[model samples]
Target: MVATRAQLIWIPSSGVGHLVSAVEIAKLLVERDDRLSITLLVLNPPRASKSNPFAELLASVSSSTASAAKSQIRFQELPYEDDPSGLGAKSNMSLAERHKPQVRAAVAELTRALDSPPLAGFIIDMFCTPMIDVANEFGVPSYMFFTCSAAFLGFMFHVLALQDDEGKDLSEFKDSDAKLDIPTLVNPLPAKVFPTVVLDEEHRVWFLGAARRFRETKGIVINSFEKLEPNALKSLLGDDKIPPVYPVGPILNLEVTGRSDKSSEILSWLDAQPSSSVVFLCFGSVGSFHDDQVNQIAHGLEKSGHRFLLSLRRPPPTGMLRAYPEEYENLAKVLPEGFLERTSERGKVIGWAPQVEVLAHPSVGGFVTHCGWNSTLESLWFGVPIAAWPLYAEQQFNAFMMVVEHGMAVEVKMDYRNDLGMETKEIVDSEVIEKAVQKLMKADGHDEKKEKVRQMSERSREALAEGDSSHLAIGRFIGDVFKNIP
Candidate 1:
């Protein structure tokens, strides 16, 4: 029953979040159409070097699919320049400038890498528009995947249109005070609501390239349920000139089945606590904290008087994260003196936990997050309230939406970033965190808000359902965009 159709190649950028979402999309595409064979184009470094997660995951998925007799999904590992992991090398520049050139290179290289088996179309990460141009070069249609809200996408596009082609400066952005046309953004937004990259000249130009490249594509695919970003979605695609848009979202449900081993341990700890007594803290994959900010956060969490599970990635050289000072890294020492001991039976600190599984758990009630789009959708999907601590970019905008517009979360308004390093200022103290946690845990007047989330979740599900808006959009894309293009 293997019907041969045009091949679709998915080019997902590196990072845990992007990689996971890309896999989910690929899996869904294959599930919907057995005739659609997919080849995930993963970029890996040399053979001797540590295998990048992108390549490793692709290999694992390929092996698992084959063993399960679902051998239609395939993987191709593209070599990187110099080292297998240019992660460190890529980090040398600000995120705004790092990937444009690499994307351009990957385009030419990827085409050559797949010389014999012609690619039918491409589904590329929003940031990797250079590949879209490559698709155009070969007379193939390309689709853009915005792994965040249409609100974020609109903001990026507006900023790009405002900037000059050279992108050497952003004088126009600094003084402007107007809300961009993002759907459902009830709060009046200022120009500063966009990411820092949009405000800087260099970053502005780099992002412009990606957006421009996107416009050249056949359509856009978003990793959001239509209900979650209604206003933003309408603003971007409601216009006839914007090309097609498909909202196939909250894709976590597709691949997620149960808790992982680490998540189970965290859930067990949460189970012992009273209902809604815990605050689940997880910044996205790469959020870093200064020692001073970390100390203050520790102080605030301790003061909150709630059961807590705080997950940290590679900790820093000193303070709570330092491994050599293992004894001091214990909750009591790392936090205020009496704080951890008082809540000892209630709190736990783990490196990483199963985020979605933990979020869906009944014991968990609130989230302290970095405001990444995926995390935003997950929190809303699970009906968890939030304490937002935005570190960078549109995170500030997301915090505004959660606290001001949606009334789903409270923003922790402490200015931690400045040229002089993070000021030792603590805006909302532990008592404040504790109070917010209490209100969120309680039924209070939040039932209406909960209903809003529930309704949105339903809409999200509907969008991805067969013959629904997103499904129809994808179907239209296959018939209209990809079918006759070649």
Candidate 2:
């Protein structure tokens, strides 16, 4: 074969899930062999200091796990202003039409930063397809990473097509049972469970613009295994509008360093607990909570009497937690009286967590999640039953897949509504949250969900082993997409 020559750039969307998934793929490229040189282009949040905690953590993790491929992996940070809210800052102001301009500006700045050298290809996040035109201008291939499963992809793409052809909007489909005739989907999902991007009419219109841009990518890669979504994979491969679909996943398994010492400490705590006794709660990197919702959630967890771990941030105004409306002490006062005292011994409320390590802990029998794809995979990898609470993006679809289709999770909200404020818009009350957590830990039918996840964990592990399907796909990607360029 010709000597390989390629340089790959990864531009991830905002959120830990996307970043983790992208990093894992980058690691895979380097681990396959030495000929691959990769540039990891991460945008710096305008407000965060040079010593950003998440970035530092990522650097540390990458350094440890990437020894074999260290020299080949390069890190570059570009100043990005995705929103003027100054990274990690949440605002109640709605700027629907204006959001695109800032996104385009960020992409332009990224493209301008890449002016020095031409590479064989660029791997952009699915949400960053505005960079496709830039990739084309530079005569480079732009592969799109969906950052989700094949079934979820099918649902999203199908919704986009409907908007293009039929002018269908979420308002028309809300709470309605419509048969989505997409191939490989196998079943029709309730529109309520679709991504919030297509939830409202204006949002649906906005999505069409983004979807149009996303469709321009040269190829699409998903973080999913073939056995998990075979039919959806087939549909993606069959679609003439898109390039071939590669199901290479359970991406976390690619890590060689495993969990850190702090992570192990938490795991140790879990190990001492009874099997299936702990409930692990984690929203995505960005949090969305209101004060009332937070109080209610706290009360619900306390009442349930289950040992829990709550990873939370202040939600937006009319937000989930009381932290936004009052002083820290005042916010603390909002929890049900005596709730903290009673549960303090059984609870850990850390600001951040080593999620994968926690999930893999034997004591962690259940997960309360925002239903983000990476979290879903991590939980599945550990055979942890999920209590699904989808907030934004493709989370709703993921929740549906886990709870409804796959039967590996339970939906926290059966009748939740969020027509009021951004923070509370999709909020499920704490009572439901409590019930879901209980069900996940121990319920009449929970064994079935637990068993399914256990089975999924086995498959996830198998897919990452040598000569396995995901492993083979990674090798192929290196050959076709990354290797032999210059």
Candidate 3:
């Protein structure tokens, strides 16, 4: 058992992707050193729905008594009342900004309830940087944890610096077709694929405020590794650009539970398939498509004649299209007419899949993904290449980085947007879907792609091992926090 203890409290932003990253990194830190303990303060609103990931994460941790005890980590809910100051649905910046005051108050209340010696430090997610003030109030050091790739951070920093040096943002390039001049980028970002933050003026202001706040923190901990983003990491660390940078990453989907059971329908079907034969298409949990888009996907899969599994969610009530939940209750109803019947032999559709487990399976060959960092890292961890389809946020940039910059993915559409904001204005036709899937799973010269990804998978595993780069970064992070702890 660990003799001396140092507990650090981590507050993650309110979303599945952000919450999962914090939990994964928290587990990695504890595993790397038993003497370290973590208290995860999940921010759940009083009127939150069951769909919230915080409850699910806490349940998973509570179910694992042995692991929880061994790691000496605790979970707490930092419940708050909602404020209606920000706009709805699309922008994360609004939500993050609205939660600032409430989070500060909740954390102050929580500080009084703690019985142990004062916390070693605060590890706050980027979305919750307002909590850094609480750490300062108690004379404790605080660090920022970025949930996305280091490359995205590098680009955002460059953009922010540009705005200060010159009053122009990326929006100026929308008409001129200019490329951003960042140090680490070999090729410049096109005007259309610019991060949504710069496209919306309010978002740009929120992002600039967030970036300014990040500079105030003691240091930053990015969920990336040296090998994954060498130049981006180098540029960020050089010039003392954005506080002290610690690259501790390749933090994967370390679910407290094992893979889904063999008896589950999808897993059972996958077990019978030959090795590396099926393509798995899963977007993020909140991701789904329009009915027109869904139909096109079905047509494409049938044309390709490849075995596939696709995860789709029914559209929301107020969106552009109508959802047929009452009459045609099944997913087939949402697809193109007669499409499912035709592809029944080769395709399986589910509302949700055990994504991490499914990716780890031997029979899985490729992924049609939204290019979220979690999904990208998980795909690389399992040696599965991607058919990159980025819908929103920093995903377009991620697609660019993976397919163009890194050469690990085939492009479905990096700039695929149907509507300007949240809705799709046009459908990805059957021809585009068919071509992308074929290239990912069945193209002739695909062995090199497979071999490249498989090697990346091995490197990811090695990066987190005892003596690798990520492992050493974690060691340094721990030492920096507690080496002078009184």
Best by lDDT: 3
- At residue 345, what lDDT does model 3 achieve? 72
> Candidate 1 vs candidate 3: which has greater lDDT?
3
lDDT by residue (tens digit), candidate 3, 357-414: 7898899999999888889999998889999998766788899888877888899988
Report the C-alpha lDDT of model 1 over 296-406, residue by residue, as the tens digit: 667766666667888755432332211111112343444555755665787887765578877877888778887877888888777777777765545767777776676
lDDT of 3 at 215: 87
Per-model TM-score on C-alpha atoms: 0.80, 0.83, 0.89
Arrange candidates by lDDT, highest first: which order? Answer: 3, 2, 1
Tens digits of per-residue lDDT for model 2, 368-431: 8878788888888888888888766667777878877788888886234332222234445667
Q: lDDT of all the models against the reference?
A: 0.61, 0.66, 0.73
Give the local distance difference test score of model 2: 0.66
* Residue pairs in collision within model 1: 45-84, 183-231, 183-232, 184-231, 304-434
Worst 10 residues of 1 by lDDT: 319-328
